[model samples]
Target chain A: MADEAHGEGGGLSFHPMDQFEVKPLFGGYDVHWYTITNVTLWLALAILAIIGLMVLTTSKRATVPGRGQSIAELMYGFVYKMVEDVTGKDGIKYFPYIMTLFMFILCANFLGLIPMSFTTTSHIAVTAILGFGVFIAVTVLGFVKNGASFLGLFWVSSAPLPLRPVLAIIEIISYFVRPVSHSIRLAGNMMAGHAVLKVFAGFAQVAAIAPVAIIGVMAIYGLEVLVSAIQAYVFTILTCVYLKDALHPHH
Target chain B: MADNTNAAAEVAAGTQAGMPQLNVGTFDNQIFWLLVTLVVIYFVLSRVALPRIAAILAERQGTITNDIAAAEDLKAKAEAAEAAYDKALADARAEAQRIAGETKAAIQADLDVAIEKADAEIAAKAAESEKAIADIRAGAQDAVKEVAKDAAKDIVALMGGKADAKSITAAVTARMKG
Candidate 1:
């Protein structure tokens, strides 16, 4: 990762995109389906963080919560309320799935912010699974729960009779584009933020500009932190919205 | 995968150029680890962490409810005790008033009986004293008549003229009676 930070004149020339490199941890040229990579390590770190807070910290399960326990309970209640408010009480049965997705992405995003850490959510491969999973599950559930009437979602019966066909086409396109937008939105945000951070960090390699580059990195890092949490919230809330549509297709 | 990493290695070792994150080569490893990590986290959260947290929240709720119920019960008990005390105090005051009234009436009744008895004794004493005075008056009159008859007999003897004793007696008794 550091190799690309140097350029021709032996003076520091920055390669901002090099921090995203995927290399084998054991030093190899070939990456297989089973290669242990930096991505694996960081993904594991995110999981460990979740367990450390949710399981290890809350092991006592005191009624008067400790700090970690409080955070865990807060997160649980926050997501639970969000799901309930967005989808109503009927959508609560899927709380576990939604909660899992939220925690995973949230942990991944925040963990990725660590200096020299690989971001799992920044990859399309990771975000695609989560986004597509929600899209497919919501589609299947809508059809199963509403039967053939599920098609009413795209029909827009409220529109004028003359405009109904055109409106349905537009709705259908938007419906199909849900997964693509969902996945790319998260990936793009994470990728863009981290790439910007790298660019600023690379600028610090020059002795004269090092101080300004570090300050810029710090300011952007703060914004990225906010973005990380907001993105997770966006993803979870969108999931709830899709669920609401499935359960109440007419609305 | 082989070509992508080969290019990355070549860049790191030789001429530096390539964004390995876009290399599509390590997608397999990243995806596999992601699945493993997410699956484990989901299980832990759903089965272990979430339940424990839920239990704690429920326990706190239950504890608060129980505390409130206990407070309510204690408040009721205190109120009942105060009411009982007030009732007892009222009853005691009423009993005291009744006893005072009964005692006053009893003392009054005893005084009335004593006054009646005293009045009757005074009347009896007066009647006896009056009878004694009347008897004394009669006795005194008889004695005076006897003395006057003796004096008259002595005067007649001294003068050498004799008077009848029965007449003297009759005269003296008549005068005293008048």
Candidate 2:
């Protein structure tokens, strides 16, 4: 349809945002809550990818790990170290939870880089759930662990007494904004990069600059690959940081 | 340009004219699926993969520790063996030295006994020769005294004087003493 749309007048026509449109997989466009949609399909694929990486590859559980097993162990150690370094020994208990998020986002991001594939993480709805889930969980944990003393996270007692109130207000506002920034940062980066890729691909329709556009797409694709991995890392590390704050809210 | 407008219209119809992410219609579906995915992942990771990997790491650590301990045990055994070998060598050297000393002392005793026996035989042989020479000299002196007495009787008889036997004997004895 996009080719026919372009064939009509020999003009370039590509929808950079169309890839983000959520359509039902089973022929109807009405995306009800129970509708099996592209989101569901990609999310399922991400699950399968995780099962392959973390479950199937490690089923043998070799002490002297083979290639696939080593990769799984490397990912495990990497995220484990991140959680430990950010959250300390107390945070090691939550390692599996954090690992699940990191693996999902990482797999989804890399899968999205495929041509014509849907990027699940590029959606605000999805990332918002992840971000808000972490925020709510950490807040609940802090309260459960520290009770009303959890509010001490906002009260900057180390500062001079006169500046305490202002700093508290600022800290409270920033604390509430954590989920917003966390979710938006990932979605925005993914959406912007994919959209830029589509725009460059759209330029390939014109005969004169097609080569340059292709080269630009290649270059950006490389950058997107880097961003895909980095964004997952950033999201997971930020979660650890928030968990650390909840566990130790003094400084 | 006409096709571009049609495509744009189609997109507007599909995504509601602005960003598809802002479209409120699909939020519920995406969120629902996301929650399902997260739950599935959480269960899978927590139940199976994480524990298995942890076990494997712990097992490896145990194995390494056991190996190091075994190595240390073996090293100690080797050192003990070397020490035994050294002790054995020293003992053998000391035994050899003792044997050599005993052999030298036995040979020295035998040599000393043989030298004493040889010196005693030479002294006995010299005493026997000296006794024989003294007996020969006494026999020669008796014979000379008898001959001198005979010569003196013959001279006295030849001079036709009566010779006294006792006086001749006394004169012979005095001459011999002189």
Candidate 3:
């Protein structure tokens, strides 16, 4: 048992690659930097593949849409409908942004499920960046559309004057924390799920002599796939909710 | 101080024994690269892909509108043709009714003329029959008078005297006077 434990620890200690690392491309330049990660390359490849698929599927524009076209159309229509439902008639203008976000996130999440792949979304920095971008966009749009009235979102004018200040303070804090919470939520969920899967997979490798551990790994893998897709959908729906608030600044 | 140095030596040996160390500041680099990727994706979607999709949608809308317009025109034409056919049918019905009425009037007039001619022929036949009856009665009365004269002449002959016109006339006149 001790020997098996040592072997397992040795396997766990192994790092796929250590030489290729993120570094400053130019000396003393903070801007225009890049990381050499398999995840980044895979993400780019996935985006290109998805875009190509969309193009090829819809190129023919047949009356009876094929399976590929149908799937593409379904994704497009889903995002479009989601925006329409969330933001009403005026939301159609933002369909492109919402669709792009949904597609990119969905592809990124799915790509991570492949063997020997990295999930960028498991990192807090990546999620934080995306969430911050949404936060800025929504806030700017709200102010642009509603002007001074956008501040009313923090103050509950319907409430009693004595309670209004407290409510406003709470609302302001929540508003500021929106991006942080959003980023943390997705990142934490993805990271924890992947970590658990990796641990379980490790256990299965070490306990391969026991058939139950192998079954456990397979079951967990299935669950991980479900979790992967659910997390992507959750992330997209939250984005839509934020967009909704921007499009209509009213309660 | 000696134990600390020994511990530092052991850590250095462990580090050299290939305990992989992640490069510091890699997270920041990952964020930068991700942002770059996001910008490129946004640009591609906004400039190239989105415009193409919009164009295709507009073209589809145009095609549907044209189809609807053509269908409406065909429907209008069909309705007009149907109305014209209905008008022609009504006219033909009216013409048939008028012709039937004219034929009925002409047949009625011919029937009246034939009845009047039959009445005139019957009247003429009745008049001729009455004249024949009056002539037959007059001839009967003359025959009666002649029989009477013959009987008187026979009586005069029985008296054995030559009958003369004047004596016969006187005897007849005397009997008529008595």
Give each model's clash number. Answer: 0, 0, 0
Ranking by lDDT: 2, 1, 3
**Candidate 3 structure quality by residue, lDDT tens digits, B29-111:** 66777777776666666676556555555677788899999999999999999999999999999999999999998988998
Tens digits of per-residue lDDT for model 2, B1-178: 6646644654653555567798887898899999999999999999988998888888989999999999999999999999999999999999999999999999999999998898898789878888888998999999988898899999889999879988998999998899
Residue pairs in steric clash, candidate 3?
Answer: none
Error of 2 at B55 (Å): 0.6
Question: TM-score of chain B, candidate 3?
Answer: 0.45
Instruction: List the lowest-lDDT window of 10 residues for candidate 1 chain B.
Output: B12-21
Work out the TM-score per prediction: 0.76, 0.79, 0.63
Best by TM-score, which number?
Answer: 2
Chain B vs. true chain B: TM-score per candidate: 0.49, 0.55, 0.45
User: Residue A52: error of model 2 in Å?
Assistant: 0.9
Q: Deviation in angstroms for A25 in model 2?
A: 1.9
Worst 10 residues of 2 chain B by lDDT: B6-15
lDDT of 1 by residue, B6-70 (tens): 45666653333555545666677777888888788889888998888888899999999999999
Docking class of 3: incorrect
Better of 1 and 2 by DockQ: 2
Which is the leading candidate under lDDT? 2
Pairs with backbone N, CA or C atoms under 3 Å apart (clashes), candidate 1: none
Error of 2 at A159 (Å): 1.0
Encode model 2's per-residue lDDT on A96-150: one tens digit a residue. Answer: 9999999999999999999999999999999999999999999999999989898
